[model samples]
Target: MSIDAIIMGIAFICIHLFANDLLPSGRIQRLKWFSFSGGLAVSYVFVYVLPTLHKEQITVKKYSDYLTMESELYFVGLIGLLIFYGIQKVVRKAQKEGENKKARTLFWMQILFFGLYNALVSYTVISHEVLGIQAVFYGLAVGMHFTAVAHDLWREYEDIYNRVGRYVLAAGILMGWIFGVNVSLPPVTETIIFAFISGAMILNVLKYELPPDEEAHFPTFAIGVISYTSITMSLKFFFQW
Candidate 1:
């Protein structure tokens, strides 16, 4: 295993495990923190993920003659978003109707799927040829992304998340890193995974950012977006990372 990649994986795991402590305690402060993270995550998606996705799409197109739709990868991305939305709907509906039993069952279901989602996204950390400063940038960007996602799960199922869900998601990151260390998936398969992750990540970040008007902090979020985007552009210019 590349030490840098392993450390990146550990960084993801830590964010999932200790996210609440890492976040602010006050309601308004927490909202602003999430808002900033949401902005950073979205900026990374547009600045980095999309360009990388283009390369993944090209690899997909080059490798597969039978599955040659230009938007096949995008369709997978859409599916990822839809899957998360569906889980959210089911959990909310069950809770709204006061079906505690159903909601509890669905809570596990949500955690499982979210863990898989985390794993898939984590796998890309190593699957991509990231190294040195590029790896650090990636960890910071996606670490913030995971923070928003973990907070959502924490809000949805705080008790269970504190007891078991966080550990499961943390384990998912470790598993993804271990798998990436052991098995090298074909470029086409890897690209498809990256596409799905991109879509899911976009949905997760936006979900928090577009919360109730009372909760949204546009100014902090705007700072996050602009600052992160500028830094990303500068890195691309100076280091070509």
Candidate 2:
């Protein structure tokens, strides 16, 4: 095994061990351990071991190939950290006695975000980038995955477990792709799809414009305009030579 593979294994073990301690010590929670171990094992195989074996099997290979996998795994691990920490914070907050309603709402919001993101991933992988603004679309897709996973976990733990899962999945996808997997299309297009779906859902759920005015019919048009302008500027800069 390469240094990267060893590093990934250590990282996964550390993260899962830390996660085991992070949750409250109540309900028959063997499932939590089971899930964490299972996920870690699967991730190890697909993201690390298999890819390493694939390259080793090849007759000729470039050093860049190995480096690319290393870089991707590094970022993927970082993404997992982001997801794990975010969920941990939320879970701690939700456990507080007075924050029940707020906790539930936040959890649901996360689910909605994941739902939209994963849907976008499914869509983009099938539909190649037509407009060419890949970042926006992929960002949106990731956002939706956050929503979907959050929703699933909300239904199960009502504790934002989905948020953690979404982060891991997104990180996995990002890193896996960076190394040479074709499981996903470009990120920009995914983000764009997420943007559209999330924008629509926000108004319906919030029952008013974003920035949340009291008036039910208040216009969030300005916010939308500014956001669009910013995206456009970013695309121009990114695509510019």
Candidate 3:
């Protein structure tokens, strides 16, 4: 297919996937603002430029706008798509397989990671304007948790092994900088520490004896909330101005 078609296709799929995650359980909802924003951001380019191509109706200004729109669509859409697929695949697999003992362990582990990931993203977005050089610290914090988990599980999930491995490596580097003797901890350090500890404590719930159905409700809500808030903020940032 043409590059334009490929971009539009990916953008559509990603926007749909992310928007679906935000839907209320068992309800069908139309596209959210983020999805529309992403759709326009992606499809508008081809809508505007492709018609003008063979008719000798194209202009440089039109081409420039198309390129700009295409770039943003691809970039933001790619990120949203990755997060959507990552969460969807894991959750679906757990659901289909009926959540065996090990699967349950891994499932809750993923939830713990999800919580930490949310807090990390929240911090990064909030501090982006103020932290300047310190933003890397937030990244490092996220990386470290990702690394520890990935390194421990890479052998099982070979498909994402490389991605997980890379996160682990970055996490190590970030941890070194954060805790290194010379570099003092930043202001967010205390809060992040508490969050990490809380995540760990919450994760221990996985160890307790419980039926699969009984354990599912809590995490379903947790993930749903995370999905809603993340998509909401992303919508505001990308479209609402």
Candidate 4:
């Protein structure tokens, strides 16, 4: 990685680590800003990431004769969503079961899943060839998404999250960045990883951010969705990506 990319990667990690603390607890839960951020993230995933994944899927199909299905990328994404959903279900069940064997097992499950998620995100951010204005936009969307993720973690784990979970996430990001800077995965492998992350992003935003229980501000969320989607679509059209 270039020095510029490495600096940007560190900056992104810092934003992910600290952005949640910048908002007050009540605002983090109830603010329209969170809705706007959620909208921005979800829109970016649908508008930019999914299309790129589709293109990658075509390329992967063209190169690899061993593949039997054309929709392998989408299936990989489905697996990602299902895996995370299963983890979430287990954790919720454990939480309801109180301080028992299942709860402890599921608590660690949540921690491990999110740690790996953060590491995957960090690795993708550093290793992807996104640059210039596109990189900035991608970083902004992901940073907002990270803010939502951090808030969810804090709400779910309370003092445990404050004491230890945040540090684990930060370490995950750093470790992922270190690996991304030093090593590179093959093209097909990278494509599969990106597809999986895209699916997880879709699941995370829809499940956590857009739920009816969330105090989402519709006007702000609509504004964010329309604005970011318009910008990204325009860029894609102009650049013919």
Candidate 5:
């Protein structure tokens, strides 16, 4: 792995481990301006991630014999979204049930899925296809994603998150980097993984960004989305990254 990839992996681990500290708490947590982070993350999805997924589609087209449908990758994305959405539903239900065993079951299920997602995203970041600075920026986009996710899990099951969830996710960061460095999968497989991860990311960003009606700040969110979109667009045009 390059130094940048190593740096990113370690940073990601720290994000999982220390997200509650990194983010604001109590009343500040519910404020609308906080949605700015979600806005920045959503901006990346539209401008950078979706286009990258389009490019990955070509690779999937070139290599696959059976999965030849033009929209198959997109279907994978949809599947990813649905999978995480189901997890969220389960978490919500478990919370309402207020049963220790059921919630514990859901918590394990949640972390396992998120752990795999974390690993795959980290794995993709260090791919040869993403290059140096691009990898760093991609890592940053995913890092914002990780921050939101980590905070959400931390909030939902604070004790379990502190005890087990963060460690599993932290290991996922290391696992992804290890796999990325040691193993090289076919381009098509990597593309599919990226697509799924992107879809899940979309749901997570929207989930956190939309919050409740009383908490969401449209003007603040819009400003974040517009400004970041402009910045990313400018960078893409100027640098072709």
Candidate 6:
């Protein structure tokens, strides 16, 4: 892996470990930041990741006579979104049940789900050869998303999340980075992974980060959305990616 990848990994770990403390506790401030992060992530997905997938699909279509599924990546993305949604529902139900045996079981299940999610994200960051400025933008946006996730987890299960959940998620990122360095998937597999992540990111950001209008800072969110979108579009236009 490149030095940039290593740095990005360390940064990701830090985000999960310390993001809660870094941001203000005020609801409005937190919501604003979340909105910004959400915008950044959403823009990256819509502008870069999806376009890249489409380009790869075209390439795959031309070369492989047997593999003719044009929208396979998008399908996998939808699956990713649904899986996370289901996990969230289960976690919410568990929270409502309060302290019980079944609640504990579901709590652990939520941890496991997030661990896998973090691992996938780390693997994508390292294995995809995202370097330089693009990597910086992607990593920053993802770090913010992680911040939102950590906040939500803590809010739901403060004691357990503080004691064990954060560590599990952190370990997931490391494990993913290690695996990504050692093992490379085929092109189609890589594309599918990317698509899945894209779907998950969209759902997570939109669902959790953006709250009701009264709670959200529309100006801040709009700035974030416009700024990141402009940057991405500019990069694509000038670099012709």
Best by TM-score: 1
Cα lDDT of model 3 by residue, 113-134, tens digit? 5434433433323322323222
Weakest lDDT window of 10 consecutive positions for candidate 1 = 205-214
- Rank list by TM-score: 1, 6, 5, 4, 2, 3
lDDT accuracy of residue 180 in candidate 6? 94
After superposition, the stretches of candidate 6 with alpha carbons farther than 4 Å from their true spots are: 62-64, 97-101
RMSD to true structure for each model, in Å: 1.5, 18.0, 18.0, 2.1, 1.9, 1.8
Candidate 2 off by > 4 Å:
1-73, 120-241
- TM-scores for all candidates? 0.94, 0.30, 0.25, 0.91, 0.92, 0.92
Candidate 6: worst 10 consecutive residues by lDDT? 56-65
Q: Clash pairs of candidate 1?
A: none
Instruction: Give lDDT for model 1.
Output: 0.84
Which window of ten consecutive residues has the lowest lDDT sum in model 2? 208-217
Clashes of each: 0, 36, 1, 0, 0, 0
* lDDT, model 2, position 92: 49
- Which parts of model 1 have CA positions greater than 4 angstroms off? 209-211
Better of 1 and 3 by TM-score: 1
Q: Could you tell me the TM-score of candidate 4?
A: 0.91
Q: Which tens-of-lDDT digit does each residue in 92-157 have in candidate 5?
A: 887888887888788888999899988988898787546566666667677777887888888788
lDDT of 2 at 42: 29
The candidate with the higher TM-score, 3 or 6, is: 6
Per-residue error for 174 in candidate 6, Å, reads 0.4
Regions more than 4 Å wrong, model 3: 1-73, 128-241
lDDT of each: 0.84, 0.38, 0.35, 0.79, 0.82, 0.81
